[model samples]
Target: MSFSIGIVGLPNVGKSTLFKALTKIKVDIAAYPFTTIHPNVGVVRVPDERLDKIAQIFKPEKITPTIIEFIDLAGLVKGAHKGEGLGNQFLAQIRNCDAILEIIRSFENPDVENVTGKIDPKNDIETIKVELELKDLEIEERNLSSPTKLLQSKSEGKEEKENLLSKKPIIYLLNTDGKTQYQVPKIKHLIMNLKDELEILELSDLEKKELGVKSKLDQLILACYNILDLITFFTVVGQKETRAWTLKNGQTAPEAGGVVHSDFQEKFIRAEVISWQKLVETGNWKKARELGQLKTVGKDYIVRDGDIIEFKI
Candidate 1:
């Protein structure tokens, strides 16, 4: 399963630096404003220890972990709603993302000019919020101007009335200097020194320990998944391949199957279910079934996090 998140903030807030750290992909990073015109998209694997444990037990030929896509968008200035500084293009890039990762700069550097001339994280956040809200209002206005009532479907009408920008969930990412401690913001957020972390990635294992650089990618992934209300389930295919899948918190068995394959959901029969812990305890699928640790669940069964499933079609 896959998810996409858009990285947004004022220019030179380390948005590009964080993107490079997250994906380990080099992109142009400059101190001046409007450095990134188009967005850069990259995928980071969801770090799961359970997949490793399953691989150990089954010794699969191939192991696949879930992934999340991150899009690094250009900065938004004050008049972004009026199409200033690639504002329209930034909005378009972010609209396709599942959620927003608002990158807030907490550190001060004289070399990098702040778009507002000074760092005020709260004001910076409000600027982006208000601009996006204005765009959402425009969208609503266009829908309201439609001529025929019969032309609008119920779902589309309801969606049009909703403010997509305001409705999209946000995960605040505080880019810090690592020395000054700041009060945690009210919204869901995680603090990290993107520059420091990225530098650490270039070091050897021993060097990392000396610098005390523990990767924050795992924590970031966990925090984002929690904010999005996501869960993971696993499928092991006869020692050949083991994979992790993502689903919404309360999705049903068939819904989870649809994530794997379209036909799996349409022709889905009963699903064999067992908790990962139970499978580990039993040591193998055959023994787990013999011990009654595995049970057949129907389409109505709600998929839980860390569930190991086998779909019968």
Candidate 2:
């Protein structure tokens, strides 16, 4: 299973442009509002140095990295929660996402139209937040006989696990032009010239290096992982393959095994675990075992990031 993040914003905020840059797959991009009615889905592999190191050491025939799926939805306008501008349909597309990336326009282009007719990131953020909160409250009211007080109170809590759009962890992305200067707050934010960078992506590796351009794509993916509170683990299949997997922050070994396969979860007996760092330091698993760096853990073991696990059924 892959972690998913939904990209949201007001019209002409470069949401689809950023999506194209990230995925290298172009979707319809225009100056008009509501250009993207249906969500555009793209899968991106999670970059890990540990996976490269493991591949280098083992010379595995195949290596599979974990991935994140990005969903780009249509823009939101005022009264979105009340079914304005296809707001309800767009919001519905993002309901199952693991996190949200709210793109705010920090650049000015008279050619492109902003639905709000201004480039105030703060106001744009509040507009999206208020609409999502209203939508969540509406959903709760329709689905439950509980009082509004309980829903409101639960919504105020730090960790929102109830699939509420407003309550989900959010990372603000400032869609900027190359020369535009914008003040960013203390919250999570990323500044990018999506169209320009997307053109850079078309260049060859040698050309990119000649231009001294190091892409921030991997950094963006890692940021998404952080907001979702995800951890990566590894499993090697004999001498043929090595693969990376993701688990939630406090998930158990059995639950993690379920991510690999259903039968692995049901038949799990125990796991041989070791940190990828320790394994690298020891040169091999046999040496790590001899050095007592390898551990035998049961179903109750909480998997840590960078753990290399061998499940015994």
Candidate 3:
């Protein structure tokens, strides 16, 4: 039920700055390598406008949104697979994450040192990719020699069944200067200036609009959802609370119930479901039922985005 994304890149690619911007958490940001020796962790709420609309209709006493954790890991360098620049520790930190957000620097600043000595996005990407692939190969080789090592690792909850770092979902973020022209890579990528974003973080919404500053952090979070193939559902507890939950795209009703509580999944019966939009349009549960918009679904029901579900156990 918990999901996380690891932020990684070469030295001084704004990994720590991006983390500070996204989570509003203060971290050590410097112009040098290994500024973040230990991984910096922060939980970010998954942005959902649907949750806001539902709360408006229900007038609940409390509203809870689903969240994802972001970890700012130490930068990786060439020969990282062989423990270059604290690479082994950094690589180990990322394996526990469900996805990766790689920061690719396209900005040129003489003050900020580029460990690779150039501002080529293509080469930078390749360097990171090769290192990750080599590390995965190293892990695979070790696993082959001692098969029980993997089993013991799983039992201790220190390793995943699929241990390849390259196999994980990755999103490349091109940290740009907004002035230079760079060739966009043919992969899942986004462009933004981390410094500019951080500057506007303290500004009011009106101030941001007046300055023509639009934040892409929301879009970045949504992209994480897409890469993970996740969907959102809702639960309204009378007039008390309305909360949002996340599930895999094709997950069934019982699995969704389990996210809320284990007993709901184990003693499952049926679910009273209605799309959030329909419920909002009709104004209440009674009106939605009167319009025949409410649906009763069994355990086999695949939960959809924006569905307001009442689980029967």
lDDT of 1 by residue, 1-313 (tens): 6778889998889999988988989898998988888899999888999888877879999999988888989998888878988888788787888788989888888898877877667778889999989988876666568745325644466444333776788988888997655555676568888888788778898988887778887888777776778899999998799999989999999999999998899899989999888888778889888988898999899999999999999
Candidate with the greatest TM-score versus the true structure = 3
- Cα-based lDDT for every prediction: 0.85, 0.85, 0.90
lDDT per residue, candidate 3, 106-159, as tens digits? 998889998888788888899999999999988878877887987788788866
| TM-score for each predicted model, relative to the true structure | 0.94, 0.91, 0.95
> Between candidates 1 and 2, which one is better according to TM-score?
1
What's the C-alpha lDDT at position 128 in model 1? 90
lDDT of 3 at 184: 74
Q: Candidate 3, after superposition: displacement of residue 49 in Å?
A: 1.2
Clashes of 3: 0
After superposition, the stretches of candidate 1 with alpha carbons farther than 4 Å from their true spots are 148-158, 161-163, 180-184
Q: Which lDDT value does model 2 have at 253?
A: 87
Q: Candidate 1 overall Cα lDDT vs. reference?
A: 0.85
Write down the TM-score for model 2: 0.91
Query: Candidate 2 — what's its lDDT?
Result: 0.85
